[model samples]
Target: MISQLTHLNWFSVLCAFIPYFILGGLWFTVFFGNPYKTSLGKGNETLPNSPIFIAGPAICCLIITITTAMLIYALNVNTLSGALEFAMVAGIGYLVTNTVNIAINPNIPRPIFYSVISGTYHLVGITIVCIIIVAMK
Candidate 1:
């Protein structure tokens, strides 16, 4: 349903996706690949095409839905309140994603180094966009 973020623009859809796209790319291609391979207990075998084969699509879909919903109500709704709600929902999503990663890789040390920063950067970006949407009106 929610496919874009533009109505109220509490947080631009493109901006939201930027962090996810970049961080996800790095995660799967670089650092995460190694850990993921080890977790699967397999060698360097190419991934296949299936719902479970590539999980990134599901994640991306989530990001799009959340931001698009935020945008849809931003204009007709209260900007500050909407922004807060958006932030909370998005922050929760970020936390859940990170926590899930840590849960999967229990051995990884606490306090994610670069990945945590990546999420924080995304939060800051969303916050800025929220502020911009409020101020622009």
Candidate 2:
């Protein structure tokens, strides 16, 4: 793990993190803004333009990108097929599941709908991160 960290391509990690973070912004605000708000029972209420909303997800994306880069380097996943496989496994197993788990609570009015929206964002975001990490290897 330590060796993998040392050998990790910092450029690729940055490249991947940027898109993942941006995707979260666009996903919630542009693509599914109305639906996402509905799922959260917010209705027509405008989302708070809080720093935590941006900073929190940015931090999460950075950690996810770095971890994905490390795993790609450590596992020697250079091929597109290997990258796709790894992305699917990690995306579905961890990212999507976790999103769904978090949505399944009293706060979210429509847990399944919320899960599909948020979970899919994570799934696609992680896939992009994985591919970038492997391609830059």
Global lDDT of each candidate: 0.51, 0.92
In order of appearance, the predictions have TM-scores of: 0.42, 0.97
Stretches of candidate 1 exceeding 4 Å from the true structure: 1-6, 49-59, 62-137
lDDT of 2 by residue, 45-110 (tens): 997898999999999999999988888888889998999999999999999999989998998999
- Worst lDDT 10-window in candidate 2: 1-10
Clashing residue pairs in candidate 1 are: none
Q: Report the Cα lDDT for residue 115, model 1.
A: 45
Highest TM-score against the true fold, candidate: 2
Candidate 2, position 61, lDDT = 95
Off by over 4 Å in 2: none
| Clashes by residue pair, model 2 | none
For candidate 1, write residues 1-137 as lDDT tens digits: 24434344444444444555465556555856655544444336765557663466546544554554465354443477776666556655765466446545645443354345445545554554454444444
Among all windows of ten consecutive residues in candidate 1, which has the lowest summed lDDT? 1-10
